[model samples]
Target: MKSLLLAVCLILALHCGEAAVTCETVAEDLYPCISYVAQGGSVPDTCCTGIRTLNSQAQTTEDRQSICRCIKSAMGGAPLDSINNALSLPAKCGVNLPFNPSPSTNCDSIN
Candidate 1:
C-alpha cells in the first residue's frame, strides 16, 4: 500500500538524518590540539577553534560518545602527564565538552 511505502521511506529518511561521528572526523578536529595534549603548554588559538567546532558538531549523545571513544583510543597507553594535559584541554580551550577526556572514562555513560 502507499501508506506502508510512505512509512518505510519516512523511517529511512529519519535514520539517514542521524549522522554517525567517525574517528577520522574526530582526529581531524583534534589535530590542532595534539601539541597541547602531548605536553603541558599554552593552548593555541587554532586548537581552541577546533575544540569549539568539535563541541558544536557533537550535538547528540551518540556523537559525544563517539568522540570520547575516539579520544581514548587516540590516547591509548599514553603517559599520565599527557592524559592529564588532555583532560585540561577543554577548560584551557574554554570549550565545555559533554564527556570528560580520560582513558578510563566510560563512553556509554557520557549521556
Candidate 2:
C-alpha cells in the first residue's frame, strides 16, 4: 500500500509539470488500482472510479509525467509481475491515461 502511494505520488509529481499536484492527491486517486495490479483480477469499481478521477485531475503534460514518476517510485521501480497489469489499466478502466506506468517511461516526454 505504501509503495502504491509512493508510486502514485511520484508519477503525479513528475507528470504534474508546473501545476505542483500533491503526492497526497495522487495517492488518494490511485490507491484502489494497486490491488488489481498486484493480484490480476477484475478491476474494482472503486479502483476504476479513482482512476477516472485521476484522469480528470491530470490534465497537463507535467501532471501526467508526475503521476508516472509517482507510480514508479511506489514500485521502487516497475515490479516485473505487476507491470503488465499496470500498463493495461487505463484502457480497461475506460480512461485515456496520458502517461505509461512503467518505471522506465519518461514522464517529461508524456505530452
Candidate 3:
C-alpha cells in the first residue's frame, strides 16, 4: 500500500513538474504582443522577448496546447488582421513552432 501511494505521488509530481507554464501565464506574457501583431508596426523588443520566453518555457506538448488554446481563445474576439499577424509572429520573432497558430490548427496534434 505504501509503495502504491509513493508511486502515485511520484506520478503526480512528475506531471506537475512538466508543466512549466499555464495558459493564464502565457496569456499574461503574450498579451502585449497583440497590438504589434494587429498593427503592422515594428514588433517591439518587449514583444519579442515575451515570445522567446514563451517558446523556452513551453517545453512539453501539453504546454504548447495550453498556449494554443489561450491564443485561440484570445484571438477569437480579435480582428482578421490580428489573426493573420499571429500566424507570422513565430517567424517574425525568430521562434520556431512545431505547429502554426491558426484557426484551423489542431493543437492536440502539435507533437
Indicate the worst ten consecutive residues by lDDT in candidate 2.
14-23
Name the lDDT value of residue 86 in candidate 3: 73
On TM-score, the candidate that comes out on top is: 1
RMSD of 2: 3.5
lDDT of 2: 0.72
TM-score of 2: 0.75
Question: Clashes per prediction?
Answer: 0, 23, 0
Tens digit of per-residue lDDT, candidate 2, span 9-32: 666555433455555677777778
lDDT of each: 0.70, 0.72, 0.66
State the lDDT at 14 in candidate 3: 35
- RMSD of candidate 1 to the truth, in angstroms, is 13.3
User: What are the clashing pairs of model 3?
Assistant: none
Instruction: Give the TM-score comparing model 3 with the true structure, all chains together.
Output: 0.75
Cα TM-score of candidate 1: 0.78
Each prediction's TM-score against the native?
0.78, 0.75, 0.75
Our tally of clashes for model 1 stands at: 0
Candidate with the greatest lDDT versus the true structure: 2
* lDDT, candidate 3, 13-40, per-residue tens: 3333235676557655665675676576
